[model samples]
Target: MPPEPPDTDPGRLLAELIAIDSVNPDLVPGGGGEAAIAGFCGAWLAARGFEVHRLEKRPGRPSLVAVARGTGGGRSLILNGHLDTVSLADYDGDPLDPCIRDGRMYGRGAFDMKGGIAAMMVAAARATAHGPLRGDVILACVADEEHASSGTEEVLESFTADAAVVTEPSHLEVTLAHKGFAWFDVEIEGRAAHGSRPELGIDAIAKAGHFLVALEELAQRLAQGPAHPLLGTGTVHASVIRGGEEPSTYPAHCRITLERRTVPGESADSVERELTAVLDRLAATVPDFHYRLARGLHREPFAADPEALIVRTLARHAEQTLGHPPAVRAEAFWTDCALLDRAGIPCLLFGVDGAGAHAATEYVDLASLDRVTDILTATIADFCS
Candidate 1:
């Protein structure tokens, strides 16, 4: 392996980054947001000769865009990573302190993605070190990925690139696809009555149970249906359910919040149609199946062209770095890659290997971090030039 750069060494940059509290407040209230961390990243990029731009979509959340300008004959490239992380409420160790044990750096955002951010930052700087490229290399360090991803959405309002790479931790693989999701809340209505008058009271919770049973059947059907080549079958499950006020009185209403994970072809509208069909069948069979399905948030799934120049460039560099072709696969989770793809930027997801995101103990593999940095450095140079 080549000697690591001192100023932007993956481990050191990640440790310094992890030391700053940049938890997304929207996910868990009172936790630090991305303002301070964005500032730190902005300054770091500025020192490396990037033209930095700071943006704040909301009051507290901020995102930084650092551009290494080029001579304007080649395709522009965007290296993107989120700044905000999930809450650190129940973490086992000090979530901020970077602990190096067994060559892994443990911290709150260690695996889930500060490692990717560090790698991309260093890689961008290294790509532009020798001389300016023929096209710009943009590093978009955005905020609120753990929640709504408002940061990336805001940045996309004005920024455009020929191709983009979201450093979203795919075990250092070139992730070409991933699942999207739609959230919905089904409210079941019932009549309240005293416990003594069982005949008069309608049990909303009990009715909800029937819906859950039907949902299980739906899940079974989904499993039996056609699957994506890489993503497998899409699925659904109840996330939060609430009903009943007291043991004595039957609950007047029940609310079940569900998330439907959609593959490439499935969308929120299609998913809603699936749920509506199930509900329609239930309403026909079950007595008084009074319910309302309210739509929540929906994020589109991402699928990149394997033959795209950016994908080919990264894959070639990855094979050279690993001595084998990097595995291309799909992720079960969503990322800002979809947003970029939607904005006409063909993007792929790639990042370092690690474990335990938003879990008890989080760490990023040190070796994998360096490998990702090296590969991305080469990829940035090749794609932009």
Candidate 2:
């Protein structure tokens, strides 16, 4: 069970969160997991009179969902934020030590995005301050966003709402779309022979060089094909390559991994087809060219309807709070909002300002955190009540 809500300032709550190491184990072996933080958040919500449910799809990996039960009369809203952060590999100072300087709270997961979690948590508490809500407000503090996103993936199996807001760092803008990425591994096979025997050996590395050239051509063609108004054209790039053992011997195999950042219209199948076309052309001309293409991980691109109910509602509230409309922008990184949107939740991304997530130093803008909390609090009251 989660502990009782601690009597502390909102910024201090964020500091406490930063002090806890919820680094994704997938990113850093033996890194602290989300169980402790999830428990704390769940308890905090429970203390605020929410119905808390602890979900653990994988062993030791937990996500907390706290719901304020409603009369089933108004619209339900989901506030989603992940609990895991990347490894602190090269951090300049102690990544877990939270400090305040120049009106910024500096620490790991502070900006990207314990600050958002703190804001949403406080907002939920304040929304129900007067009385019970007409509609349910679900607080989804999940795990595993940094690596596989298995936490949100697991939650989507059952939990849902009319709309959702992912509190990912967005510089306080409304992020309506983001690029998705797919990883593909290509293997080229050739006959091994002594390097001196050029006629007897088929060079797989040389063949890969041809594919690299073709990849550039494919990139050019893709850049010229079409573009998303917000996301622009898709992109493809070679990630890593491995082949050859000794200089005296012709390596029998070459393996290459490539990544494709997809825009709205692209899919894994489409990407595979495009790569197959490249290999097909090479096969027609290059002698002894044999290879196989295998698809790895893929996350679909997300694009929210700018006119969505959640979008309009958040915008109105944000404008009322900021004295101007929040900018609607696109993100280069992906978020769990894509999964929520795919499940018909009409979710959008929003968060505070700061930088240096997974970097040497990190922090969240203290003022932005307070502003986001106030905006979200008012938004919940207006939309759910």
Q: Which pairs of residues have clashing backbones in candidate 1?
A: none
Per-candidate local distance difference test? 0.92, 0.89
Q: Each prediction's Cα RMSD?
A: 1.2, 3.1
Window of ten residues with lowest summed lDDT in model 2: 1-10
Q: How many backbone clashes can be found in candidate 2?
A: 0
**Clash counts for the predictions, in order:** 0, 0
- So what's the TM-score on candidate 2? 0.96
lDDT of 2 by residue, 38-58 (tens): 988888788888899988989
Give lDDT tens digits, candidate 1, residues 1-385: 6666579687899999999999898878898999899999999999989999998869988899999999989899999999988888788989998999998999999998899999999999889988899999999999988888999999999788999999988998899999999999999888899999989999999889999999988899999999999999999999999999999998889999999999999899999998998888888899977899999999998899999999999999999999999999899999999999999999899999999988999999999999999999999998988
Which regions of candidate 1 fall more than 4 Å away from where they truly are?
none
TM-scores, one per candidate:
0.98, 0.96
